[model samples]
Target: MNTFRAARFALRAKPTASFLGRRTYADAAGPSDKIRLSLTMPHQAIFKGTDVVQVNIPAETGDMGVLANHVPSVEQLRPGLVEIIEEAGSTRQYFVSGGFAVVQPNSQLSVNAVEAYTLDEFSIEAARAQLAESQKIASGQGSEADIAEAKIEVEVLESLIAALK
Candidate 1:
């Protein structure tokens, strides 16, 4: 009977001793330290499990900046710029045609976009011309589906133009 009691006490005490040395949330590493990022599109993978210091995404809820240890969330991205701050402190920007941004619990950010491209890859003149054409169709007496498609194009083009500026 005494041996059974001693064994129980030892097991309970061992757990308490380990728990006492455990670090609290406040004592843990900073959230802005670093995070793994994977930015992908249909045609190419922009970032393949790369470590980045920060990432600013244009989510439907609002523009949000994510860092290491960010709260896990699945956000609907808007057609706008996705800025990635690399480990070397250089910032790279890409215009995404709307998709999703997923922040995992394990300090990982995955952004899957319908289309993404650098600003220099776009021509301002071409965008402006397309914008004009889209606006004309959107406001014209076209079919409902055609008008809706034109409106969507207008929105995306406007975002792209804003990012290029």
Candidate 2:
């Protein structure tokens, strides 16, 4: 059985070079390349120079996808989900409050958000309750500043609900 297992492992192994069991820099930026992504929030860095196949972000202009060698540009993000496609064909999604996404030269992407978390981290019941409260405050005869803050809260909660779907 041990010999059979060793043979199976040998058959599954490839000749590609790896570093610490991770893909090498050359592999990440090879001819069939991936973009290096840096997704940062105020309190945490979700992705720190990680290589990915594509990234879909909700920008104020519109929803956009960034791929390797994409044009360098800056986009103001809206409160929504950011999807990251990795080299292994797995995808990660994060809900960001709002911020900026900058596609730098040499296939580098940087996203700085006010807050971010995975969709599973959110409680839909809590969001719905808050949304209802925000709506009430935004529509009521509250102070201008209070109404404005409530409106913003409503917008963010609505977006989060939409993303959860």
Candidate 3:
């Protein structure tokens, strides 16, 4: 009976949405009406009741911002900043690197990354270190592959730093 119960529990247990190995959020943020996000780790977020908003992202071409119910599309994100409308009707921003964002017109959104968090979680000290490292690599002109890697890292780090209040 005990073994059977354990098996049942395992089958019914909820999965976790983690970032870079660290558990990001068992349930990162609550659902909303305007936008609903589904993560791979088995979590969902909703941005309901948002009419107009902004989403800043580092795109393959460059940085771009999207508005509410803009359109159904997908983009390869770069390391950079993202902006959104807070529930309080204020601007909310975050740092994202090496991820893709999905958009829908009627009300849909999904952003997946190696790691992601709010601006509140960023630290100044961490940003400085990353900036220094990125600058060093940029000066070297290391290689196309290396430059791309460095650019992505720098972008993500910068995004984190910008979130620092």
Candidate 4:
């Protein structure tokens, strides 16, 4: 049997056994329940299989909060802030360029982004200068591709600036 089929069979055979090798029952979720979050970039793994209380993501559809037992869905992320509420009641925010967020059936959220940085890591002056340059290039007589790229940069910079505020 294929690996996927075998896994499916195993899951069916054991309703309480999740794909993450954890056992979960169909019980009413509570605030104490934790969701495993995996936030990854190309070169870094921000939160790898870490349990958290909640996560607020900036999806293309809209901003949504994910908690344990959230309905399974995939969301395309936009350039904005991702707020993670840790188990200890502390919140951390990161600015992600763009990516996808997947809420799995097993109380897990996986976020893959092109780029991500903490709010403190950004320099307002530098971002403002870059935004100005990108705006100029987007309005200038550059190639269509260059103009399009600059426009995307402008969008990201604007979002980053807003997040920094």
lDDT per residue as tens, model 1, 134-162 = 99999999999999999999999998998
Q: Output the number of the lDDT-best candidate.
A: 4
TM-score per prediction, in order, is: 0.80, 0.80, 0.53, 0.80
Tell me the tens digit of each residue's lDDT in model 4 across 4-113.
45543443331232543333333344333788899999999999999997788998977877767655679899999999999889999999989999988777889999
Q: What digit string (tens of lDDT, one per residue) describes model 3 on residues 55-130?
A: 5566675665544333356778776666665446787665655678776544455666665566667678878888
Model 3: residue 106 alpha-carbon error in angstroms: 3.5
lDDT of 2 by residue, 63-148 (tens): 87776655567889999999998999999999999999998757788999989999999999999999999999999999999999
Residue 59 Cα positional deviation in candidate 3, in Å, after optimal superposition: 3.1
Better of 3 and 4 by TM-score: 4
Off by over 4 Å in 2: 1-32
Q: Please give the distance, in angstroms, between residue 5's alpha carbon in candidate 3 and its true position after superposition.
A: 57
lDDT of each: 0.81, 0.81, 0.54, 0.82
* Model 1 weakest lDDT span, ten residues long: 18-27
User: How does residue 14 of candidate 4 score in lDDT?
Assistant: 19
The local lDDT score (0 to 100) that residue 105 gets in candidate 2 is 58
